[model samples]
Target chain A: MKNNFRNSKLLVIEDNSDHRFFIEKAMKTCLSEVSAIHMSTEQQAIAYMDSCLYQEWDLPTLILLDLYLPNRENGWRILEHIRQMPTPINQIPIVMLSYSNQRDDIAEAYQKGISSYLVKPTHEEEWVSYFQKLRSYWWETVTLPKMRFSF
Target chain B: MKNNFRNSKLLVIEDNSDHRFFIEKAMKTCLSEVSAIHMSTEQQAIAYMDSCLYQEWDLPTLILLDLYLPNRENGWRILEHIRQMPTPINQIPIVMLSYSNQRDDIAEAYQKGISSYLVKPTHEEEWVSYFQKLRSYWWETVTLPKMRFSF
Candidate 1:
């Protein structure tokens, strides 16, 4: 895939250090022009989103969301807020990248209007290949709505 | 995947005999419980759908729609009619499976609310694998809206 054609950014929200490192390492070979921003806490993610809104920055094209968080609000709440946001922020494609295998979680996420739900692959190669295909389709093939809000 | 689940049907509307055979063969390995119904002409497909409605039978779970059909009305017109249908047929997932590589076709199909757009892979093995994944995700894994009315 042509790297220049898809320069969309990705945000990864996870609390685990090992998982963060694994994602970073695996993404190197899988996707082209992917820049991932990570946060260890749900508060941090909310704060980051707040800052982005204040600064009027373009939202990431895709978000890899984890269901669990450090404290207080969880990923589902965050997703709900994002979906309810005005204008461009509401249009960003958010995919649940969680280890939770519960059918209810999957069902609930889809019901809440999640773009996609993927169980975190166990192996590094599997993770890489999965994200590669995901990036290729979401960024290159899919006509994603713009995510920059204007007053 | 367990093959004991409620069997979902697939109606593939395609004009090419080879392509129909290819899809049927591929679907057999991946979707054992799925009953695939294929039609080479628009008249036959419409007739089948109408007959299902007339007999008060449940419609197919999903449709692998081909854009080019041998009839007066094109695929889009059929799709529009399906969307306008009164009962269970209105809610069926219609994933467009087409050979058209044109960007306009892709854009228009999605704009018309296609569940998914899949390009026909050139390689046989790749086609099989791709269709397997499609079957798993779209047919077996995803829980579609319940059929409200038969026909």
Candidate 2:
């Protein structure tokens, strides 16, 4: 696959340290230019988003969120918070990266307006291919909303 | 990429005949087994979904919707109608395919709960690659929600 995702920012909210490291490594290896920001807790993620709004910072191109988090609100709550944001801020794509393949979780995520739901792969090779295909689809095939930052 | 999409159904609601043909052809070419059902009007799409509910028929794995349709309700209206459906049906992924790259359109589509927004490629090669990447991402990398048909 071609690398069309250069210079794109990806914000990931994952509680597990190993999963976070794997995702960051896979994304950086797969995309030509990727700035993957990690937040281990829901509070941190929300705080980061608030700071972005306050500073008028450019929002990440995509958000990789874990369904279950430790010591804070879960991914569903985060999804709701983002969706309630005004205008373009609410339009950013959010893909849920969780281990839960439960029917209720999948249904709820879609209903909550997730861009996509992906079950994390178990093996290392699978993760590599997963990130590769994801980058190809989002960067090459999809037309993301043009982010408008109010000056 | 693995052909995990065998026997999967895709409902396409597009007004333009040429675009429909291209999408169907591309999907068929990329996936090992794909049933691409085309609906030119919004009414037909609704009718199909209703039939699936009434007859306990297998719903499509993904819905390819056009933002602007020739007759009846547009894509946004259709999206709203689907999202209001009960349970699993509402969970079906809806991807908007449009020639319009307007910021308003993209933002509105995402806000209304589209899974992804894709700009229709102008060239044939681009369409082929687009479908290939989309199939790889959705069928291989992502775990789609299990459809529940109430008899």
Candidate 3:
């Protein structure tokens, strides 16, 4: 598949450092020219989004969010907040990447408006394959919303 | 990837007969055992959904929606109506597949809460590739919410 995500910027809100690193690395490998903004906490992510709104910064093409945060149930809250925002900001696709495979958690995330839910793989090889498939589908096949910088 | 979607059903809302056939064919080719329900208009889709609800029939795992419909601007309306429905029904992932690649259309669909927006490709080879990628990503890699029959 062609690198359709060469110029895309992605926002990843993952608390685990190792996971964040792997995701960033995988995304970079998947897309020739990609800029990924990583956030380890809910507050940081909110602050970044707020700043982007206030400063008219270009919004990320996609958001990869972790379900379980370090010390709070903030993933769902964050998703709800984004969905409640005005216009284009609310339109950004949020894909939940979590270890929880419980039906309740999956149902709850979809109910909260996650674009898709992916179960985090335990094996490193599985992670690689998962990200590769993700890159192929989302970046190559899906037509992501064009982020307009003008407000 | 294992056939996680063996017993799953898919709801396809498209006005064109050719598109519906192709989608159904592609999905069947991708998944070993998949039942796809096709509707040509918004009214039909709504009636089908209502019947499924009333009859306690199994809801679809995914919805492939067309942006333009016959005689009305019903795509967004249908999406909004589904989202307003009670819990599990509203949680069904709606993927918008349209020929229109307009930024406004894409942005509007996402704002209306479509899980993903894919531009309907004209070429047969492209459609095959798209459906293959879609099946791999959604059916195999992603965790779909379990459809609960009981309200």
Candidate 4:
């Protein structure tokens, strides 16, 4: 049976303008009906989340997080804060998008309850395909609990 | 840069003959060149694993496991035994495949270090699609360290 829902919405937390633009272009080119909210700073991401809560919009289904950012604290700290949030928001899947594939990075992400750890690809086509495959599999196939279904 | 390896070898640890046959057929149809092995008993599975070690073949990329089996003990007990084994085989990814979607079941599976918890789908297509997508995303697209690579 064909899935009725459009591709899942995503929140991308990355500091680099070029990388963010590339990812947005890739998603638009590959996945269907996926909208992304990109934030360059941790403060901006937190502000957007607060606004989402205030406006009562459903939180994004997946978060693509870059471990390194222009901000002082970095992405893991943001993930920690989001995980501490009361409900509805805490359940969103956060996948780490990082350049480092160090064992420590993988171990720490798993320890912090990140859904998945991915090493960013060097090639543009590979990167695009990564998100395309992610969309096709995770958003289209997996039966994740909707925001309304969350506590 | 498309991934060269598009399929994964999977081991399904379950005792029910009907369910095993259903899953086997599903994998054969939905997956491309996937090697699927089904073991009905823990003793048989462990025995097969021992034989595989002598053959110098790599461990299956993912394990789909049922929590309950015909054996007197639970699957978690078998998982505990696997975790204690030395390197090489100890690192295989185990995905808990079960009909139980209870919160406690999910929590316990994660606690015991299951790679993922999949609630067995009622429909055949959904079941086929679930395993196919998992193989595509986790095994094909993601970078899983070989047993020899883990430090």
Model 2 clashing residue pairs (backbone): none
- Ranked candidates (lDDT, high to low): 3, 2, 4, 1
State in Å the error of residue B112, model 4. Answer: 10
Q: What tens digits encode model 4's per-residue C-alpha lDDT throughout B16-103? A: 7777877887777776576887787888777776765665354666677888775325687767766555554655656677776666
| Candidate 4 residue-wise lDDT at A54 | 59
Task: State the lDDT of candidate 4 residue by residue for A1-151, as single tens digits.
Answer: 2241444478899888778877987888876476787887888888777776755454776788888775325777887877776555666667788877766565566556566667888877777889877876656654343464333
Q: What does candidate 1's lDDT look like per residue over B97-132, in tens digits?
A: 777756567556654546556677777776677676
After TM-score superposition, the amount by which residue A73's alpha carbon in candidate 3 deviates from its true location, in angstroms, is 1.9
Q: Candidate 4: where is the Cα deviation over 4 Å? A: A1-7, A70-73, A149-151, B1-15, B26-129, B145-151
lDDT string for model 3 (A21-132, tens) is 7786677666546578888888888887777676545577788999898633788778888888766788889999998888899899999899999989887667778778
DockQ, per model, reads 0.12, 0.79, 0.89, 0.23
In angstroms, the error of model 2 at B59 is 1.0
Measured against the true structure, the TM-scores of the candidates, in listed sequence, are 0.58, 0.92, 0.92, 0.68
**B-chain TM-scores per prediction:** 0.87, 0.90, 0.90, 0.83
Model 3 chain B lowest lDDT segment of ten: B1-10
Error of 3 at A52 (Å): 1.0
lDDT of each: 0.66, 0.79, 0.80, 0.68
> In model 2, how large is the Cα lDDT of residue A60?
81
Across residues A16-89, which tens digit of lDDT does each residue of candidate 1 receive? 78778778877777765777888777778777776767665445767778887753248878888776765556
Q: Identify the leading candidate in terms of lDDT.
A: 3
Stretch of 10 with least lDDT, candidate 3 chain A: A1-10
Q: What is the interface RMSD of candidate 4, in Å?
A: 4.3
Model 1: runs farther than 4 Å from truth?
A1-5, A54-57, A70-73, A147-151, B1-151
